[model samples]
Target: MKNIIITGTSRGIGFEMVKLFAEAGHNVLALSRNSKPISDLNLKNVSALSFDISDESEIVKLGGYLQTAMKKVDILINNAGYLVSKSFSELSSQEFKECYIVNVLGPATLMRTVLPFMKKDGHVVNISSMGGVQGSVKFPGLSAYSSSKGAILTLTELLAEEYKESGPSFNALAIGSVQTEMLEEAFPGLKAPLLPIEMAEYIMDFSLTGNKFYNGKILQVSSTTP
Candidate 1:
């Protein structure tokens, strides 16, 4: 069983992923800002760590903690992210910076910190969005969020190329609109978003077997298979 690290586990997709991986007997390191509700399924091999992803100091501390563990991380899931939906004109510089910090900087920093502890067969899965893909339709209030995710896509491609010789794969999953806290926060009145647990199950399965086929490709997780 692989040792996997996942961020943003307090709720939503990250929380579900922790359940899925732990149930599958993988050693899971779950990180989030708040302490997640304890689960019997996760008690076996899941560890919960709390830190704000947007804080560089906190990430550095986490890096030190993981370094001390000295165990090679088999899989790293850059799943912690946030969205602030507002028109470009309405968005402040502070908001843009905050988005960049969480969406782009946090993943990049985590990847850097974990790289030395990753084995040759390790994999890094970046959680991007359809807004990051080329030819995706533009949405007015999502400029900052889309831009950050788009940068993540580019980072994924670059890392895939950089680690090609090492045999550790890097890929990005441009998930479709899933039913999560972030979606509800973005569109409060919207109904029928995909459930977080369902999406997490799909992601866990994909991470186990789909990397060989999907490395460096943006796979969409939507209701209808394309």
Candidate 2:
């Protein structure tokens, strides 16, 4: 089985993903802002660590911890992000910076630090939002969140091309809205078209097989209903 590292694993999709990988017998390293949920799992194949992804010092600590056991990481899922719903004029520069750090910089820093441990033909799956894509339906309150995800999409392509010779692929999944706490925070009255577990299953399959057919792509996950 592959060695997989997933960020934002305290709850929602990331939490489900760790269970998916662990149950399948892969070596899973799960990172989160709080470790209680993952710690409670008690899965033999899973190791949970807690750290705020937006903090550089914390990221460094995570890197150092991984250096000991991960000679080769088969997959890295940059799944942690922060979100705040507010109109552009109401949003502060600090809010944008915070969103950018968690959504973009955290992944970039973690990806760079983990590069050496990535095995050949391994994959990096960046979690994004459909709202990040250029042609997506614009939501006024999601400007900061969508923009941060857009930036990650760009990074995915750049990294994939830059590491072409190394054989490890990078791709971004601009996921459709899933029924998670994040979505509830974004749209309180609406029901999502997908659930976290379903998205986790899709992500797992794509991480294992999509790199061969599609690398450096921003695959949008959405439904016809909107």
Candidate 3:
């Protein structure tokens, strides 16, 4: 069975991913800021880790745990993210910084920590957003979120090129809104046609086998339901 690592396991996309991976019999290292919900799942193949992605000290400790917990990770999905919707005039600098910290830097740091443990031909999928998709769909109050995803797109391209021969395949999924708490918060009272379970299935398949021939791609995974 492959070893998989996924972040943001407290709920939504992360939660569904853990469920699908463990049920598929893969060894899963599920990380979340509040992992108690995952622990309650009681799945043997899933190991829940509690820590915010933005917390460096927590990430360092998790790195240590990873050293002894598994010899190789076949997939690393940087699925953790944050969003704060505010108009340009109302958005604070601190909020912008925090958004980038969770949405961009956290993934970068985690990737660095887990690189040595990645198996040959491993896959790394960074969860991005259609909100960040250039010239496609633009929302009014997502400057921080959009820019952060743009940064992720760049990182995916650079990393894919930097380790073309040795490192894992890197890609970003610029997904549209999926039905989740995060989505509800981002656009209150609006319903998304896509579901978290559907996204999880796609991610599991991609991480397990589909991405072997792809690299540096920023795929727009979305249903055209506006």
Candidate 4:
């Protein structure tokens, strides 16, 4: 069984991912700002950690703790993210900075911290957005969020190239509008979005296949019937 680490497990997609992975017999290190709500599940394979991913110092401490624990992570899912919608003209500099901190720097910091402890056959899954795709239309108030996800896509490609021959794999998953807290936060008027459990299931299935065809490529997930 794989030892997987997933960030942002408090709710939504991250929470569902934790449940799915643990049920699949993998040992999951689930981290988020808050404890997972399903505390009653009592799964022996799941451990919950709480920390603010935007804080580099906290992440460094987590890295030290993991090293001391000597638990090698086979999969790293950079799933924690945020979205603050405001028109470019109305968005303050500080707001943009905060977006970058959580959406970009957090993942970068985690990847750096865990790199040394990752096994040769490890996998890195970056949760990007459909907005990151080329020529994607811009949402009026999503400049910061879109740009950050776009950067993540580039980062994924670069990492995949860097690790191509060294072992392990890096890929970016461009998720479409999924029913999650973030989506509701971005569009409060919308009645419903894609369910989190469905998305989580698809992601877990994709990861377990050991398919290299998608490595260094972006896999987009949407609710549209194929």
lDDT of 1 by residue, 92-131 (tens): 9999988889999988988988888887678889999888
Candidate 4 lDDT over residue span 129-152, tens digit each: 887776766668889888999999
Candidate 2: tens digits of C-alpha lDDT, residues 40-102: 989978989877888889877777787787768899999998999999999999999999999
**Which scores higher on lDDT, 2 or 4?**
2
In model 3, how large is the Cα lDDT of residue 119?
Answer: 56
Native-vs-model 4 lDDT? 0.83
Estimate the TM-score for candidate 3: 0.97
| Candidate 2 segments whose C-alpha is farther than 4 A from its true place | none
lDDT of model 3 at residue 102? 93
Candidate 3 local Cα displacement, residue 223, angstroms? 1.5
Candidate with best lDDT: 2
TM-scores of the models, in the given order?
A: 0.93, 0.97, 0.97, 0.93
Clashing residue pairs, backbone N/CA/C < 3 A, model 3: none
